[model samples]
Every structure is written in structure tokens, then in C-alpha cells.
Target: MALITALGPITIDMYLPTFPDIAQDLQVSSHEIELTVSSYLLGLSVAQLFIGPITDRYGRKKPLLFGLGLYLLATISCALAPSFDMLLVSRTLQAFGAAACIVIPRAVIRDHYSTQEAAHALSLLMLIMGLAPVLAPMAGSFLGPIIGWRGLFAVMLVVAVLLIILCIIKLEESLKPENAVKLSAKTISSNYFGLLRHRNFMAFALSGGLGMAGLFSFIASSPTIFITQFGIAPENFGFFFGLNAGGLILGSQISVRMLRKHPSFSVLKIALLLGLGCCAIGLLLTLTGLMNLSLFVICMFFFSACLGVINPNATALALKEQGGRLGVASALMGCMLFLFGTLTSSLVSSWQTGTTLPLFTSLFVCIGISFICGRFVGRA
Candidate 1:
């Protein structure tokens, strides 16, 4: 599950350090290269809309296999693209196919686990998934010089093929046939709409989604901010990037320990509240030109730590709170979550390219919203 979830972030993070190289080779601006991020996110958010119905109707294994097949094809197209336009098109299709890897794993987890066990399982998954950021950029930076940026896509394709084989060999269909929902558009719509209307679902989803949005903003903006603004070398930027991701792993493990003694809700509240304060200070520092790499990394670590704690717990809370149709519920929560990703990523992509102001501002605002949503959720 962690490996499957890692694909989404690895695809985004691995190629970040190769931006300047890609721009030079493809004869494009940094802004144009970043649009590839937006394009992929758009496809991902849209794909989240329907995977629920399909996955629920069929069991987990078939749709997963089907998606991986398309992912392989799209990734191969990405590697071989001769033009920037072709690369963008291929990335969108690649993300559309990769959506299954991101969304279905949660459904699979929710299918068998509940409460503290579910939270613990998800934390373990996140602990592993968090390592992708720690390693992907370094791998890409190391390999980009040797094989060029296009080779990174080829590498991802190889991983996808290998993951598919592993799935075939080891993963069983988790959603039992008798438990699967009967196929129909109305049932799908009803389940989705019902979940959306539940205040608990909306609350946890928004809180978690906002945290994810903050993370996406950081990822989208980091290449420019770290390399172009801070004068970090392409290859060494992974060290700083890995530092923040390492915080996530630490925070997740800490949350796992905290959960053993505390309720998930309290852990979430403390994490988000701390995140808001940290992000606000980060923004203040950026706006005043007091922000250095050390300060930036520190602030980002706390915020991402909060996110690492929030996501799995919030997801477990939302899934456990909703009683029926785990597939649709999971899908809706994922759709909303990536809805935040799509929006924040686009926001970062559209910002003036060289400034860290957007990164700081986006993080501050998103964290603020997360805390506010949590308060309202408690009241609701």
C-alpha cells in the first residue's frame, strides 16, 4: 500500500530537480515546465471522481490491474515524447491511470480495519510512503545527469511494471464479491452525496484536504524557491527536500506513538494548531526577507509533520464514521482531498516564478483554514 501511494509523490518529486535541464532540452520556460504538474494534477483530481464506482462494482484487483496497464502505456509515452505538448498530454493520461494506485489502497485498508487498528495501519503505510520524498529527488538528481530528465520517466515506468507484477503475485482481492455494491449510477451518486452531506465526513475531509493542499503548494513551489531563489544546486536540493520529508516520517511515527496514549482527534487538533502557528511564522519571515533556508526547512518540517499526522487519522476517522459503501466514501473523500491538491498546485504554478512568497503564503492560509475547519467540525 505504501509503495502504491508512493508512486504519486515520486512521479511528482523525482523530476523536480531536473527542471532546468528539462526546460533547456525542451526549449520551454520554468513556468511552462511547471504546468506539467498542474496538468497531471487536473487529470488526477478528475480521475478520482469515478474510480469509486468502478472499484466498488468490481473487486480491488481487476481495476487496479487495468489502471496499471494504462499507466504503463502512458508512462512509456511520456518517456518517448519528442515535444513539450506531447509530454503534457502523456502526463495527464499517466496521472489518470495512476489514480487507482492512490485511491484504492485506502479503500482496501478501510475494508478490513477500523478504529485504532486502522489508524495504526495507515500510519505504518505513511511511514513508508514518506520515504519516497526522501529518496526520489536524490535518485532523479543522480540519474538525470547520466540519462537525462526523460530517463526519470522511463525509470518510473519500470517501477510501475514491477509493482504490477508484485501485485499479481502477492495482493489478493480485498473487497469480497458478495460485499460489492451492485452496479448503477444512481447508487453511486446516492452514496457519494450522502457521504458529502455528513458533517463528520466533510469536517475530517476538509481538515485533511487543507493539510494536503499545503503540502502540494510546497512541492510545486520548492523547485523554484530552493534552486532559483536560494541558489541551491540541483543535485544537492534533494538533501533539503529530504529533510522536510524526513520530518514527515518522524511526525508520523510520533503520531503513531501518540495514538497509543491519546485519541486521534486530540492528536489532530494539536498537530494542526501547531502547524498554523509554525506556518504563520514562516510567512512572516518570508515577507520580511528574514527567511533563510534553515528557517524555511524548520517551518516546513513542522507543517508537513502536522500533515503526516492529520491525513491518516482524518482518513480513518472519516471512513470509520461513515457506515456503508466504503468504496464510494473513500472515493469522495479522495476526490475532495485531491481537489485541494489540484487547486493549490495550480495556485503555486500560476504564481510569479521566482518568489518564495507564494509558498509561504499558501502554506499559512491553508493551515489556517485547516484549523478553522477543525473548530467548526467540533461545533457541528
Candidate 2:
């Protein structure tokens, strides 16, 4: 699960330091290179619709293996991509493949664990997973100058192969044959619709999705905001990025400790309030022109830290009601996140003004959505 969660962040973070190089080499605008990132997110979002149902029906191990295999192939394609179009295509494919690695793991955990245990397990997984965002950018910043952007993909290819081998050797099929549903059109549609109608599921999904949107917005706009607007050096980007990730790590650690004592809802409400406060402050600073890079980074760290609390609690709450259809439930949650993330990211990319407006607006909207959904949408 840790490996699966880490893969998406690794794919994104490893290439971030290379964005400038990729733009220069491909002779495209930086915005175009950013489009590749959003395109990957779009592919991940769309693919989850299919991958979730397929995994739910067939079982976790097979689809996971197949997805990792495709991921290996896609990473190689990215490494050898000759043009920006090819890179974009390869990135989309890579994200599609990566989606399985992400969605299936949560379903698998839900399959095997109770709600609190699942939250505990996810917290541990996130602790491991957080290392990718913390370290991959730094590694890429150093390695990209040495091996170029292509080499980063080569490294990802190697990681994919290792993950495949690990899955083949150690992973057991967790979904019982009796629990697997037939993948008929009617059954798929009915199952999805059922989940959609579950108020708690939708509420929790929206809570996590909107919380995540803030992070995605930061990532989509950060390069331009930090390097271009604030004139931070490329190497320093990872340093600051890692600080935000560290905040997430710290928050997750706090969550792990809190889960032993408090109910999930209690933690979630508190975290959401903190997240809303942090984002509101960030936006206020931006509006007042008091938002320097340091202040922005500090605000981001607090907001992301709150997400650590928001995500696990919301996921646990959502899946608690999903008795037998954990896979579809997990997929729906993943889909909402990636879909909203892709949309918001594209909007941010399109509105690239070299100012803080796009970032603040997106953050504000995400927190507002999370607050509204959490307050009104869930069951008592």
C-alpha cells in the first residue's frame, strides 16, 4: 500500500525539478509542460472509473499486477518520448497505469481491516508514502542535471519493475470469490449509483477530495509561483517543497497518535477547522500583499498538515458504511479526488498570471467546499 501510494507522488515529484529542462528541450512553453502534469492527472481520474469496478469484480492481485506491468511500459515510453506530444501521451498512460496501484490498495485494506485498524494501517502507509514527495524532488533536482529528464523516467521504470516483482512474490489475493461481483453493465451501474446515493460516502469523499484539492493546487502552480514569481532557485524548490511534505508527515504522525485515543470524527472535525483556518489565513495574506514565499510556504505546511488528519478519517468514515463494495467505494472516492484535482489544476494552469490569485482562489474554494460538505452532507 505504501509503495502504491508513493508511486503517483514519485512520478510527479521526480519530474518537477526537470520541468525547466523539459520545456527547454522540447521547445515548448513551461505551461505546456505543466499541461503534461494535468494530463496525467486527467488520465488517472478517468481510468479509475474502469479500474475500480474491474478490481472489485476480478480481485485485487491480478488487476494490480497488470496495472504495474502497464506502468512499467508507460514509464519506458516516457523516457523515450521524442516530442512534447509523445511525452503527454506517455504521461497519460503512466497515470492510467498508476491508478490501479493507488485505488486497489485502499480497497484491499478495506477488505481486510476494521475502520480504526484501516485508519491505523493507512497512517502507517502514508508515513512511508510521504517519503516520495519529500525526497523525490530533491533527488530529481540533483539527478536531472546529471542524467536529464529522461533518466528520471528510467528510474521510475526500474521502480515499477521492482514493485511488480514484489507484488508477484509477496501479495496474496485478499478478495474472496464469494465477495466478487459479476462485472455486468447493470451490476456496475447499480453498484456505482448505490454508492453515489450514500450520503455519508459522498460527504466523506468530498471532504477528502476538497482537502486534497488545496495540495494539488499548490503543486500545479508552485513552480511558477516559487521559481518564476518569487525567483527561488530550482535546487531550493525541493527544499521548500519538502518542508510542506514534512508538515503532512508531522500531521499524519499526530493522527496516528490521536487515533489511539479519539474517535475518527472528532479528529476529522478538528483537522478540517485547522485546514480551513490555515487556508483562510493564506488567502488573507495574499490579498493583503503580505504573502511572501516564506509566509506562503508556512501556510501551505499547515494546510497540508491538516490534510493528514482529514484524509484518513474521511476515508475510514466513508468506507465504514460500505459493507461489501469496498472496491467501488474506494474507486468513487479516488475518482472524485483526481477528477476535481485535474479540473482545478487545469484551471490553475490556464490562469497562470505569475501572481498568487490562482493559488489563493483555488485554496479558498477547496476549503469552502470541504466545510460545506462536511457540515451539511453527512449523516448524523
The digit string of per-residue lDDT tens for model 2 on 1-380 reads: 78877998899778887888999998999979988877888888888888888998899999999999988998999999889999999999999899998899999888888888788787777776667887887788778989999999999988998898899999999999988888999988998999988889999889988888778888778878888999999767777777777887888889999989987877888888888888788878887888898788888888888888788878888898886688888888888998888778779978976678888889889988887777667653
C-alpha-based local distance difference test score of model 2: 0.85
Residue 34, candidate 1: Cα error in Å is 2.8
- What residue runs in model 2 are displaced by over 4 Å at the alpha carbon? 23-30, 352-355
Tens digits of per-residue lDDT, candidate 1, 1-380, equal 78988888888778977889888888999879988987887888788767777888897888888888889999999888888999999999998888888778888888778766677788888887889877887788789899988899999999999999989999998997777887788888888888778888778888888888888888777877888888998767777877778878888898899999988778888888888898889889878889887788888888788778888887887777654477677777777777887788778878874667888788888878888776557422
Off by over 4 Å in 1: 20-30, 286-290, 348-357, 378-380
TM-scores of the candidates are 0.91, 0.93
After TM-score superposition, what is the CA distance of residue 380 in candidate 2 from its true location, in Å? 6.3
Please report how far candidate 2 places residue 179 from its true position, in Å.
0.7
Cα-based lDDT at residue 103, candidate 1? 76
> Which ten contiguous residues of candidate 2 have the minimum total lDDT?
371-380
**Cα lDDT, model 2, residue 345:** 75
